[model samples]
Target: MKRMVSASAAAVSMLLAGTTHAAVVPDYQLNSSWYSNAQNAISARSTSLSADSKAKNIIVFVGDGMGISTQTAARILQGQSQANNQGGEENYLSFEHFPHSGLAKTYNTNQQTPDSAGTMTAMMSGAKTKAGVIGVSDNVNRGDCDVSSERLVSALELAASQHKATGIISTARITHATPAATYAHVSERNWEASVPEECVGKVSDIAYQLIHQAADIDVIMGGGRRNFLPEEVTDPEGSTGRRSDGNNLIEDWQNFHRTGQYVWDSEGFNAIDTSSTSKVLGLFNSSHMEYEADRDDADEPSLSAMTEKAIDILLNDTHQQQQQGFFLMVESGRIDHAHHGGNAARALQDTIEYSNAVQAAIDKLDAAGELDDTLIIVTADHSHVFTMAGYPKRGNPILGLVVGVGSEQPSLAGDNKPYTTLGYANGPGAAASFDAGVRTDLSALDTKQLDFQQQALIPSGSETHAGEDVAVFARGPQAYLIQGAIEQNVIFHAINQAADLGGNAYVAEE
Candidate 1:
């Protein structure tokens, strides 16, 4: 009986020891096997390419809805034709010249093609989530999600926690989906400018949460001044929109007068002393700033200008010297809106503008000797259903109709045609008729076509999101981590690992 009792005690002790050991060690070991395989494959492709040390600053450029096809289409429209005989020029979108390039699958759990909220949330937090969801997971209660411990820390928050200065610049409203995902938490992505009646008098709006919760927002630029102002402030159209709160949020921002500077126009933005100002709030337009093509002034800063200004201010912080680095997120968010409106001209122009912003970052960082120290990553949150198909003549206008050649073209049964101008799966301006024989003037068509055989899917109107993978171009430290196909959330992890931001607490261990 004594020997049996001793045996039982030994078993219990062993079991407890095993449980303690498991608790001490992380269950999910760092699986370098995949990384090692990728490294080997990379070595086989190029001997010159090698990973660099840790980056000092990280600049992420997200072209809101600029998918891979969008990039390809933009390249072609920007004079890089994809023809065999014609001399096609290679016009790099600044970051494309980077030593590393990769593809990222942009899909949320709920949808194959995700909205900016879910996609950006993944990029910012390094966690997969449902479509239309922003910041927090679907499991968390909506109102408490932001302050919940289960909520994942954003890359911006992580950088701030490490003492780095952070900034978010966008061409859309500062409270728009992409930018909002980085700082604000809500059940829906569209909650940025939204004010629920339940919390109207008691709690702050998402816009307020964005500015107030952000511990180190050195630069805040873009539109959505309507949300910031009281009902009294006349909008750009000279009318007062709905205001849930009697308190003017813009005035609230100004109350922090000594610590911040607010600019209402381009001239004001340029006049501000970035050297002296630690915090800047620039609202150039009442809503989204004018389209890049529509802008008249050469002196007026574009999205690129705002990005440069943000970087300048963030890097100037003297306190937390060790955290002297800056993490800036710049977004060309209007691309998606333009696509939704079925404005090819506007969409492509926005793409070019986005590329220009990327170029500006490259030039500024290069000039400041920060290019090598900065990990500049350029990508899109998701893609639109925008496509370019049909065999047009070499150097043909991308905005023009698709013409088919005789003999080589597919047979058209009784006036049924084989070519189309442009198409969408389901958008507002989709091709109205299925019969190609109905020769509608291509010049009058709103959206472009994908050129698939049989019936072409039309978009509801101007916009549609694509479920395709987006391109990621990277430069500087650990850029190699961005090679090959990867999940959208992996981008945050790669950035975190490259910057040594530490573990992803959101990812559960198997």
Candidate 2:
């Protein structure tokens, strides 16, 4: 079959032949297998890639622990949710139909199986780091206090430094690893509220870093209200703050921007005038926000709502006056938390919510005429131990028990017990009540219940992350660079190249 050479590879070849291109990506990264192998794979797959183009605005959507299996299950669940729908397997999540798609090998420098801190760092900073560190290189120890020289610059910071608007939103605490990597640099991801007394003077905690260092961030939203408020102050929702430092970072945030609004509830969020708001900070929950399946009375904005509002606030900023564009990162963080609890129902629901957020960004940007110039990337930091099996007949409920293709009743195992269509490799669910060495019979239970935990093979407190490649989907501007199997860090390079962010693969502004 005839294959077209990738526009990026062709451009690189011609540029190399003509002039010496300046490279800002580290020499170690340029020499590593992760980087070189990704380049080769993209070049070999260029035949299916799109023409090279530069993007003015960039939006990245991260579905935490959303492995390929989770995506497939979520797509089917969504399809089945619609009226008069066929089997869910025929459905596609919003980003799945992007023109370019590939797999990203998600691993930290120290471990084969990755964690959010390391994986997100790779995507935001163009370099991989240790599993427990955020926005810093692997050269430093996991909990080391001093990281001045080891800190890495993220795409958001680079964009903001160039006078472009930047924003971050998540369903988890904003100080959590995934969202934190976009702005805060810390040796330990847990230093959200405060650090050890011995290390206090040497390094600031994540929340403190956000308020003091990343002052230019235009829109900030998600949970972790406790991290920002003082211990003596209780939020309107009755949750007490956790900050030992007695620092009201929310007040500090307001002091930084005279026109910025700090909102903690749905009423405040809905009242914000995105058209005139210079900046906004929203902390809907004291911890991570409620899972989508349980968010009805939570008084918090949905992931889709947060995403749409963040885009609007960024678009309205006059500081982005030069047309330098903006960079926004949206994370569906609770998907990982739900998977860790072995609850596939909640996980799938949150994944669907995440897909809606992606669609929301696309719709909003397209309506604003920014879609064509915006490079939107949808991907996951890593995979969970979740699995889907059984040859169930078509039109079966995704959350239902495993009923075989030809049977009217649930399928039985060799041990004479019924099972669900979804299960985990290892998790708390593995300890399901046992009766005389036989597994618990799930036939009498409602497997589709929101609180139901899927059965697992090995007993564990929580399901672990899988050491496999996750899917990456892209559309608009330099998206062709996403083709073929690539390293996770390649995401940062793609964004840099597409936006001319002065990286090794940087494309000169036309």
Candidate 3:
């Protein structure tokens, strides 16, 4: 069921953007109905709007490459799916209803349109860094280990230090940029399994850091199974592991957490008892996990399933009473990958799935009556160059061609060719790739297919990141800090404050 909450709902009036004086309604019309409502909304949140004394739990959802347009498109696509729907603009994703939201400047120190490694580092470590660095200061070079001595501690590390349970979940490889930022510190995001020979002894690989440097990951679930196993170890899929190192990190991780269970498939994942089990490590794929649209091959758990399991395990059944709170990061990592591949359908599908995962977490929190104490922050690491253009009529299918208001045919371009409503500014879909002089008419094509790639302007093998600010949506305790146009590092501050990790808690550790 759609849990509809009025944007003007009390306690959330101006919490998201933290703007109370009316961003839309201008001019001082004190006698107008709009003015009266605005006043009431501001008055509504005046009672208790301070940061939480201490948050019992914290969950951050990063929909990689989910820009403003991606979010808007997904919201409409999801809305249009329902039998009872208006123009679709009225439709809201589960997390969109979050009382607190703000814009985050996603650029890194070195690049305008940031990479996941740097952007996620800002959010997870409370420090802005260069484009390709992970969990380290911006002073280090991309591949140089000589300056890798200084590492910025992450919120998860701090949470772990405070004796709180910590976990990371993703649709991509667990050792990928987003999740790795929560734990690993390395010069390059690509150094997953095989560290370069020159830096082998000096710099540890990401997968190596996951088992060694990371805080006690109570509920680690994602792909990147090959990165942990040795080269001789054959994965369940018959693919050999990538580690040149003789060590099998999987068994080592299991041994590190004596009671922890290592799982590599759906059967093992689903059968585990999160209540009695304090730790879980599951890698479902050899590398990146399958997209939601293409998961028929195996009995893989959906993002929602993984989210629920992580939440359950972190909560520790309350009876165990071993951990006070938890910090979890859930990433829809393939949204960015699909965009880079120029597949709009896959990206939007993954965004919807990310929304579903957020909803699942919300449901779990509500069921446990922890909504008041658990802070939920949903944002993105960066954005893609994908765009939604060619204005179509209201309620038009988001993935369909741009149809004129009264005409049955789609709008024609300068070359007399029809275009799709969704497309990339520059990507593999660009017409230049086929022929510089010809434009393919998309009218007859199955643009709505799951594998469909939106047409682009330039011919690039992969789409590039867009240099624009992404959105941050928050709910629960201390979410008010999420308001206003802010830098990406502010996210770490908000979460750190909410969880009472102490101001700049990790600085002392460094």
Candidate 4:
């Protein structure tokens, strides 16, 4: 057999040229053994993976900025959180065992690394748009709202037209880029509450579109209360509303859907009678919801709780004569925010919570006997610079210092100091600019703390989104589409093809 070198091993060789044993680094761990393991995994998938002939309900779980490295670290953390730290590497975060998965190239029409608006628009609208734009084609200039003719239709709109009951659940503001891409059309993603002074009257902000552009939502739950209320109405959080139009959209929502119930806290969210209520509207926090680690101080529901409620409500409609199944998007949105601050602990914790939410949805569907009838797709809008590096043994603590094979103590880096197992490429963790280059000594710090920020190579104002591809895991109808490297826009097409939402449903202009 040819002596084929894995790219990972090749990189290691290039980095350690002229050093003895450069030809082989046991710690690098990309040898024939790795090849065999990967091949075996693929063979297993071929035998066990099968898509449902039809999917009556579609659930898309978005873990924003959750790259492959993030997933690995989070999976290990989730496993370690268990009693006695049993089988960390083998611990499957809900979607790890998903039958079908593929890498999605997340580039936008104009940029290599994309913003949430463009990446999510690609997922929701079957067309890759420009960075900073949402639910509109590349023809529209950012911040210019007069592109009504260039506005792109979205998967949620197609679901609405198909008579499917739908829901949106997120840890982000309801009007944030990810959720807004599902329904709203705007040249700029930041137009969540108020349009630009120049674009006013010509364009509707994201919050406005959530109500006016898409009136058929069966469940709407997230934060961003400011965007829905009048300035005079102070929320329980002591913040004023952001709506400049003076419209109390919450009141409008109540009046418009007289049968729907509006709630702002966990108690109210928990009290909703999914069996009796025609619709549900929940706004947990004044802005973005608290991170899962900080949720103990408030009555805001967890991602899992909200997911169950949405699934139950969407399922309740299936008993109605007009029900055409459902489409639900659940986002573990806070992961992106945590990564922005270079807080690896919070980011991984959010990933775990997001996994719990996905498990909750699967459990709910299974209990309702809708498992086979529903399609669940777990993916990220794009990747962050999150990485798990250093040569840690299989059972070493994911958050602790890396321990090389056969070594009981943490290994020292080239700087002769211990480094963390997880780190960022560039973030607040970087002590100085890239030109200066500062490395922190993490040997004495508690890297497992929820507030801990991992080390980075380049000091940035904030960590940046990565240009690398993200993974998409799928089950149920049309899951076969997610078998190899794919364009991000294929997500919308796969769902549309499976649900029969009519071809080319995302074409801009009516």
* Winner by lDDT: 2
lDDT of 3 by residue, 136-208 (tens): 7777879987443446667787677666788899989999999999988788999999778898678789998
Q: State how far residue 336 of model 1 sits from its true place (Å).
A: 0.5
How much is the lDDT of residue 376 in candidate 1?
Answer: 85
lDDT of each: 0.66, 0.84, 0.80, 0.79
lDDT of 2 by residue, 1-510 (tens): 332222244433432222122212344444445444544444454446655768889999999999999999999999999987887778889998899899999989999999999999999987778999998778889989887656666788767655678899998999999999998878999999999887988889999988876537889999999999889999988999999889999989899888889998898999999988868999999999999988953498999999999888888756456437889999999999999999999999999999999999999999988999999999999999899888888878889988888789998888888888899999999888355567998878999988999988888998999999999999998888887788898898788777877544222233
Rank candidates by TM-score, best first. Answer: 2, 3, 4, 1
User: Considering every candidate listed, which one attains the maximal TM-score?
Assistant: 2
Query: Which 10-residue span in candidate 3 carries the lowest summed lDDT?
Result: 20-29
Give the clashing pairs for model 3: 16-100, 16-101
Residue clash pairs of candidate 2: 4-47, 6-46
> Residues 239-296, candidate 4, lDDT per residue (tens digit)?
8998888988888889888878999997788789988786888998889999998896
- Residue 380 error, candidate 1, Å: 0.7
Worst 10-residue stretch by lDDT in candidate 2?
Answer: 15-24
Better of 2 and 4 by lDDT: 2
**Where does the lowest 10-residue lDDT sum fall in candidate 4?**
18-27
TM-score of 3: 0.88
lDDT of model 4, residue 456: 84
